[model samples]
Target: MHVPDGFINAPVSAAAGLAAAGAVAVSLRGARRELDDRTAPLAGLVAAFIFAVQMLNFPVAAGTSGHLLGGALAAILVGPHTGVLCISVVLLMQGVLFADGGLTALGVNITVMGAVTVLVAYGLFRGLVKVLPRSRRSVTVASFVASLVSVPAAAAAFTAIYAIGGTTDVPLSKVLTAMVGVHVLIGIGEAVITTATVGAVIAVRPDLVYGARGLAAPLKLRVGGELVDATPAPAPVEPVAARSTKKVWITGLATALVLAGFVSFYASASPDGLEKVAADQGIDKKAEEHAAADSPLADYGVSGLTDARLSGGLAGTIGVGGTVLVGTGVFWAVRRRRAGAPAPAERETV
Candidate 1:
């Protein structure tokens, strides 16, 4: 959940800010190992896709809606470090440009929604995959369960953060129950979306999926009295991004565009779990005005756009484009850093 400004005291908020900054710094370094020439751009596309799907909030309860947190999905498709960066980039964009989250609460959003979700979901996913059958179905199942758990975990994390820094006098027990209760329902939706998306990608280009790698090795078979590898010996190394990579990338981008540009119009208009909880629990009483409240694209609508649908559509499109551009740039830089000093090191001319 995107914590608005003033929900937490300045001291706790500042502490969260420092924690988020450190986490991001570590992720940047770790992502260098995760992203390559091929996945670097894919990472950007993943961020864009997450941004798009998050716009399509689905109704969870009677008046509570939920959207893709993208942490589990991204961690499954890419790697955990990159996944954290992906959500962070989306949060940054939403905060600065769309006023969806508070600038002051950026740290809280990143810590809860980005760092905690990615770490917890990815860890569970890895553990499950190790014990489950080594098949695509297992991967999808693991993804679903990991995503399902991650939502409530995030809810608990937010509750903890609030307990430490909440501006209101509400009892922590009530807040914990309500947050986890609604979010568990939201987690179901998260599981469905994560499973379906990961299943689709695994069906097509499993190589493009970071977590699915090594899971689809050539099937071994019995020969005579012994088992043998079915595939021939490997050839010279090639770039990870092949023709199929382009196809999958393009397809994913197109799907994201369709979802954000048109499908989002039908999304539920009800408040999300966190918003509803905040209102019901009086956690939002001291919510201050967003720093970007006066921005032209505030609230996911253009300033001069007359048609609500058209304005929202344009905003979503722009958000996707912006997230993709910025995310790609960041990932590309990380990748470049990974392939450091591309040229061979020169020998000393002694």
Candidate 2:
């Protein structure tokens, strides 16, 4: 959920900002351990994909809609640390460029939509993967469940935050009930998107999917009339060409572009779960206008563009491009840090 300005008092918002900053700092370190040549670039694409998919909001209730939060999907595809960064990137882009989320509420959005969702979804996903059969289908199933739960978990997080810093006098119980109830329906949409995306990636390149790694059952042998674990054979050395991620990367980027640039036009126009709840629960009574409302790309449309399709489509494309660029740069830097090498500029000087 994109929390707008003035919804939370300054003190609580500042606290959340500190918490979100701490989480981002921790994730940057953790991501160094997770990012590699194969995953670093893909992580950027994942952020772009999340941004693209989020534009296609699906109807949840009569007047409410929902979109992919991307926490579970990213965690399943990359890793939790990287997933948090991905959602944070998307949120930042939306806030600063699209004016979709408020500048002052950036921390609240990141805490609820980025940190909380990734922690809950990834933690639950790992637990389910351990108990379930180690199969691709099981990974998809786990993803579905994890994503479904993450939405409500984020909703609850927002409710708790509001309870502490809400600007209005709405009843906590009413706000919680409404937020959780509406988001439960929204969670279904999140689950479907996560499951399909995870399943598709697992089918094509399971190695690229962090959650699906090591899913293949180990070999077994019969010894002395008892089945025993077989010694693992040395993995075959794959050719450089065979290990290339260019194809998948290109395909994924293309898919994201298509989704944001075109398919988003058909998405439901209904207010999303958070917006609906805020309006109904009086959470927006003191909501302030986005600081970036005057930006050319505000409201997901280009300035002075008459054609809705052209304006929105262009904005979406620009957003995808910008997210991929920024995300890739961040992840690549983390990968370099993990390798214990200086950045390109430093290396050049050395």
Candidate 3:
């Protein structure tokens, strides 16, 4: 959920900001280890896709709606550290350009939506993968479950944050119940999207999916009375596999454009889980105005554009474009950093 300004007080907001900063610092380093030539470029596309799908909020309960969170999907497709970075990039773009989330709540959003979800989902996905059969189906299953749990987990985290710094005087139990209940419904939507996306990727390029790598269980042959490992010949990369990567990227970008530019018009207009909880608990009574409320593209709509479609369309396009550019640049830099090249100054003037 994109927490707007005023939900939390100054001290709690500052604390969340610091926590987000720390998480990004850690993600930068961790991503250096995860991203590479093959996946680094793809990570940006993933971020863009996340940005697109997030615009398409699906109806959850009767009046509530939810959108893809992207933490589990990213971690399953890419690596956890890089997943965090991907989501962080999208959140950053959405915050500054679209004014989707509060400037002060930037840290809060990233920490809860990016860092915490990635860590928990990735851990759960890996653990399940280890126990389940080593197949693409298993990977998809694990991703689904991980995503399902991560939503409620994020809701719980927000409750904890609210308990610490909620400006309004609401009972913690009420807040927790409302947050968890609505988010649980939202979690179903998240799980479906995550599973489908991960399944599609795994089907095309299991090797490219970080979580699916090394998923083929080693074969065993019965010898005498005991089971012995059978060292099968290494499988060669197939011709379809070579083109799969490019196809997936093109398809992903195309899908992103479709969702953000057109399909987003159909998204539910009802308040999401967070907004509902805030209103019900009276936690938003003292909610402050956003610092960047006057931005040209605030609220995911252009200021001067009279037509709602045109304004939101342009903003959505800009968001997708910015997410791809910034995310790609960050991931490419992380890849370079991991490669351990020295600064140009260290090479001496030529």
Ranking by lDDT: 2, 1, 3
Alpha-carbon error at 306 in model 2, in Å? Answer: 0.6
Each candidate structure's TM-score, on Cα atoms with residue i matched to residue i, is 0.94, 0.96, 0.93
- Candidate 1 vs candidate 2: the lDDT winner is 2
Give a tens-digit lDDT track for model 1, residues 161-193.
999999999989999999999999999999999
Worst 10 residues of 3 by lDDT: 237-246
Better of 2 and 3 by TM-score: 2
Q: Candidate 2 residues 107-168, lDDT tens each?
A: 99999999999999999999999999888889999999999999999999999999999999
Q: Provide the overall lDDT of each model, using Cα atoms, as 2-decimal numbers.
A: 0.91, 0.93, 0.87
Model 3 whole-model lDDT (C-alpha atoms): 0.87
Candidate 1: RMSD over Cα atoms? 2.5
Alpha-carbon runs more than 4 Å astray in model 3: 225-227, 234-244, 341-350
Put down candidate 3 lDDT per residue, 1-350, tens digits, no spaces: 99988888889999999998888898888888788777888999999999999998888887788888899889888899889889999888888877688889888899889988898899999999999998888888899899999999999998999889888888999899989898889999999999988888777777789999888877999999889999899878677546546777788888888888778877889888898778778988987777777889888888999998888888888778888889989899889887885567966864
Better of 2 and 3 by lDDT: 2
Instruction: Give residue 104's error in model 1 in angstroms.
Output: 0.5
TM-score of 3: 0.93
